[model samples]
Target: MRATTIHAPFDMRVEEVPEPVVQFPTDAVVRVLRSCICGSDLWAYRGEAARQPGQRIGHEFLGVVEETGSDVTTVQRGDLVVAPFMWSDGVCDYCRDGLTTSCEHGGFWGTVGSDGGQGEAVRVPFADGTLVQLPREAASDDRLLSALLTLSDVLGTGHHAALGAGVRPGATVAVVGDGAVGLCAVLAAKRLGAERIIALGRHQVRTDIARRFGATDVVAARGDEAVAAVRELTRGQGAHAVVEAVGTEQSMRTAIGVTRDGGAVGFVGVPHGSGTGVDLGVMFDRNIALRGGVAPVRSYIPELLPDVLDGTIDPSPVFDMTVDLNGVPDGYKAMDERVALKVLVTNG
Candidate 1:
């Protein structure tokens, strides 16, 4: 089988790799039908995130079960399913509290000794607890399959950010960043019944998707200018709730700046570089609440699945480019260069 591997910064290659096979009672083997590139993947592509030579990449996938371990009961061979980016045991104390990302036994894919999602197949651990069952017929339903794929990561992450920020009916919301996750945050805020959504981004293509996803205002600026734009849009009071989808010091500051005095900020961006961009005194003075971390998408799947299946929300537009297993290297380039909002990798 062939999978994507990173050799160095700006170097991604699809090469033949050993195929995956179940090795534990909790394991399942899945033949991947769809997987996509994540913005976080760019960290490794740029060498910002270290990797061993030939390390596998990607964390989102929807597939069909080819085989399951003896202990796996929730799904079996021939079931169509979606695997969350992180595999968890489902019955842990933290998992029980809806914080599966902190599950003691869980781990992320594409890490050392784990199979990558951007491949022909994957060896899924904790199979019954990690893979969510989808209708077998979904294999032939491209539209639904694409939308369902987002449940593995971006959509769920956005939902987590919205929930963290305490999004509620009739509230004013602002989202920092126009990445796929940011656009989905607008969608999630709408799903949570926000009356107004302000999206901060400079790219028209992505902001257009933000609007389609539910953004009522677009601020195509950055830094203080963006903070001013959002404040102006919110009648100089700032948003009642804000989702910080871009993981950067400035974006974090912008999120905090544009949040109302008593509002909350839900941050989901993968933090890198120095400082968290937080000031304790500033937060104390405003009584602002800050929450959110690596989204526990495995826990969010069930809550968001029903809406995706029913078409109440659609996040597929985030995938503006599609590539096959062979075109993955180029896919990264497209995203890193800002030519595509997101890339979808497919295998028929």
Candidate 2:
């Protein structure tokens, strides 16, 4: 088997690697069909996240089940599945509370305790709890791939942001970032009945997708200018709901500052330590609500999968760059340079 490995910043390689095999009673082996690159993956690729040499990359995948552990009766061989980015034990306390992302036994994929989806095949732990079995009818459906794949992360996280932000019918919502997750937030806000969806992106392609998904306004400004634009659009009152999809101090501040007093802000960005210095006093004075962290993808997959299967949403456009497993380096570069919104890597 061959997989994408990051040796250092700007030094990524696709190399031959050992195939994964089921190692635990609760494990399942999946032959990855479509795996895509994530923005978070760039942290390691740039040496900002300190990834070990030869570490497998990617956390989002939709694939076929090749094998399952002895105790895995919920899913069987040949079934198409979507594995949540966060592996969890379904019965854990936090999982029961719909916070599977923080499950007592939760483990993130593609890192120290796990392997990512950037290879021919990968082993998923807690198969029954972590892998969501798609209906057979949806297995061969071409349109389901993008939306189904999103259940592993972006879509679910977007939904979490929307829900946490308390997006409502006729509400004005602003989203920071035009990445897959941000576009999905726009889509989520639309689904939640938000009347005005404001998306911030300088790229025409991304802005177009955000519009197609549901954004009613697009702000091409960055930093303070973007925040000011959001406020102006809302009659200087700011948006009723704001979602921070980019994990940066600028984006986070924009999200908070552009939201109306007493409104809510949902942040799903993989905070790289920049979220710690927020002005809690301002948040308190304005009566603003701040919520959101790692997306509890496992808990939301079931609800969102049906919408994907039925064509209620189309997230596939996010995959603007599709390449073979061997093109991993380009995939990483395309995203880091903002040349691609999302890169889809195929194993076959």
Candidate 3:
């Protein structure tokens, strides 16, 4: 099978790799039908996140179950399923509490001996806990496939941001960042009943999608200007809640600054650069709450799957470009150059 491997920064290639097989009783071998590059995947591609030479990369994917281990009963052969970015055992205490990302036995794909999602197939551990089964008929629908694919990561992470920020009916919520995750956060806020969704993004392409996703206001400003814009929209007060989707110091500061005192900020960006650290004094003085991490996507998949299948929320617009497995390097470049919001890779 051919898979994506990162030899170094800006160097991605497709190489022939051995196919995966069920290695654990709780594992299942999925024939990847669709996969995509994630914004976070850029961290390693840019050398921000250390990467081993020839390391397998990618994590968002949905597929058909080709085989299941003896202990895997929840999914069977031919069932179309989606695997969360992280794999977790369903019975762990953290998983039971809806924090599966912190499960005792949870692990990410493309690490050590695990298979990455950007390939023909992958061996998914904790299959019963990590894989969400979709209607068998969904395989033939392009719209549903795109939406289901987002459930594996970006969409769920966006939903996590909204949930963490404590978005409520009639509340004014500001989303910081205009990436795919940021746009999805806007959608999640709308679904949660936020009356006003303020999106802070400079790119017109993404801001346009944010509007379609339910952003009531698009503030193309940054720093002080961005904060002021949000404040102006909120009638001199900041938003009641803020979702910080870009994990940068400036973005985090913007999120904190634009949030009303006593409000919360849900930060989901993978912290990078000077924005990696935060000033506790600032948060303390404002009485602001911060919550978010690697989203417990598995926990949210069940809740969001129905909406995706029923066409209640269409997130496919985030995928602005499509490519075959071999065109992944160009996909990365498109995103890096800001030419594409997200890239969808189909197994062809």
Candidate 2, 164: how far from true, in Å? 1.6
Model 3 lDDT per residue over 26-120, tens place: 99999999999999999988998888888888899999999999999999999999999999999999999989999999998888678898989
Candidates in order, TM-scores: namely 0.99, 0.96, 0.98
The superposed Cα distance between candidate 1 and the true structure at residue 57, in angstroms, equals 0.9
Candidate 2 lowest-lDDT run of ten: 270-279
State residue 294's C-alpha deviation in candidate 1, in Å: 0.6
What candidate 3 gets wrong by more than 4 Å, as runs, is 274-277
Instruction: Report, for every candidate in turn, its global Cα lDDT versus the true structure.
Output: 0.93, 0.86, 0.92
Write the residue-wise lDDT of candidate 1 on 93-194 in tens digits: 998998999999999999999998999999999998899999888788888888999999999999999998999999999999899999989999999999
lDDT by residue for model 2 (210-288), tens? 9999999999998789888988899998998999898887788888888899999998987876355367887899888
Best by lDDT: 1
Error of 3 at 74 (Å): 0.3
Query: How many times do residue backbones clash in model 1?
Result: 0
